[model samples]
Target: MTSPFLSLPGAVGSPVAQHYGAPVAEQRALDAGDAAVDLSHRGIITVAGPDRLSWLNSMTSQQLLGLAPGVSTETLLLDPNGRIEHAIRVVDDGERAWLLVDEGSAEPLAAFLNRMRFALRVEVADVSADFAAVLAFAGGTALAALRALGPVVEWADPWAEVTRGGTQYANGEHAGAEWSAVQLVFPTERLGAVARAVAPAGLMALDALEIRAWRPSRVADVDERAIPHEFDWLRSAVHLTKGCYRGQETVAKVHNLGHPPRRLVMLHLDGSEGELPVAGALVFREGEASDPEARPVGRITRAALHHEWGGIAFALLKRSVPADVTLAVRAGAEAADPQAPVEGVIAAAQEMIVPTDAGATRTIPKLKRL
Candidate 1:
């Protein structure tokens, strides 16, 4: 079997985790100093037309009308009911806009955009197979390396545009500090040059970095039933007043009045190490039966062994759960196969405590003037 990490310079390495999972160390470096992620699996949707700007503006929560060359913004593709179908980072190159999103959202998002193309001269295609996208977090030397590669075109705070020769790249946050969510596109033949230029890594490192930074992805990291508010994607994605879109009403109402029934929190485990909670396990504050089974206080989203915290995890827990709550991971068993009970309790295998400042306040600029 192959290892789950990719080698890189100035770091231990990156992750080779499935496209959906980034390793815990990569996530930590990303949040603390500098790091990079291979977004080769992310889906890219291209939209071009005179109506592209206005049309996309009418649909997403981002204020695309003001987007100029070399700038980017994160937004959500919401269902009619305000649930996030997917989260996307939008990049405007003046002539065309690119939607960078989760790998799973490619087909559905393409179909949605294609179906919406009525009189508007818009075309949407799933370009996932065409591009080699990677995300980098650099400051000082790393930033200099990137700037040497291209002209810094625009700025969206941590996100900016840099172009080298004629190739264009977009920069954004993987965790924090100085970062660049870079994309390189060309005939598949030229991928080697791009890889060498940027230093390729695996998805495991990216997940590690994401865990440290507290960035939650949709797949195993979150329940599909989760509202966007719960993940705090609104901090970076949803614009307060970008006019109306599909689920703007719910977004607005929830943002102003109601709190999300649950929230995403970072957890530190006791790590006694008998049987840890897997990615989709149920988490109970005190024990089961206190709450409906369907209504678990939280679900274990991403779990990884941290160099500092030992066993660290990201969970979507109820707001009512105490920060210091002792939680248990309920083990699952199959029928007729009773080495033990199919639904046996792990018996306080680990104490689940929220990491300090998991939900700290962030100050975002009102405008993209930079």
Candidate 2:
């Protein structure tokens, strides 16, 4: 379905945003709570029935059974091997539990939840078609206005602190402590009116804010091999003391006995080349002029030029790589051109997001065997 924002002048539809005319101006307005962004592309799933909370608590890596109304938390569905499957943003209104997910995931997630309902009084539905999500930075007024449009639920992100039963790997101050973005869900029919009610920013503005906060998102930062420990997701998503779930054993072992094989890092890129490296670009450690054995140690997951930070990226690198290492990202196309022999690269300075010794529990002293 076409977004209602397309009716606005200079509206451009991309996979992420429905941006109106001036994106920069829109971004400033959004940051100041003078505008909003249409994020209707994100999916929504509603789980209803008396057993909603218990059923969700038993299936994911969070302590959700005691979640209070309007309280926001996130949970992760992991495979039996502890690899992340889905990262869901959750909120409840006492009677219904809402799961906000990445685009294209609602149907499959709801289907999975339905299959798990065995004699349980639960009903799962993909309600994405009925509701649209609107986000605003510092959006108290926007939220108050959205509440008047009919059943609306606001989800305040809990990224600033370590949630109960979760662990923190990043030391010192977290970059996301000031993150104040909120998600509001309203009737899909009100989408056009909502778009017209306020100035609108593009997804690019949202990306800059998220990256600056060191916030990891499912759609942009995750892959098949991603584990919660790698991205420091346990900060707000995974509960270490939660009862047995699909990936409980692996989660326990990694947190208590071992470190994650890889870690997440932020890269400050050299924008001198006038272009940014695309996702999946190879990241290599700085090499000596005569060194012929240098190999890529990581790959870029998300890259964007921030209004304040210039070119910045989040990448997954080998845990063994030092936090202070200087790196370079290959700028050439993934498939080399036979006609064009130039191979471009961008230099990047690494900023640690996940610490080298992330799993402190592993350092606990053990008893000597006889």
Using lDDT as the measure, the top candidate is 2
Model 2 misplaced stretches (Cα beyond 4 Å): 15-18, 139-141, 148-151, 288-293, 333-342, 364-370
Estimated TM-score per prediction?
0.72, 0.92
Instruction: Score each candidate by Cα lDDT.
Output: 0.57, 0.82
lDDT of 1 by residue, 82-196 (tens): 8878777777777778787776788888898888889997777787776545455554233344344452132232222221111111113333333444443333344344345
Q: In model 1, how large is the Cα lDDT of residue 60?
A: 80
The per-prediction CA RMSD against the true structure, in angstroms, equals: 9.5, 2.7
Query: Candidate 2, overall lDDT?
Result: 0.82
Model 1: per-residue Cα lDDT at residue 233: 63
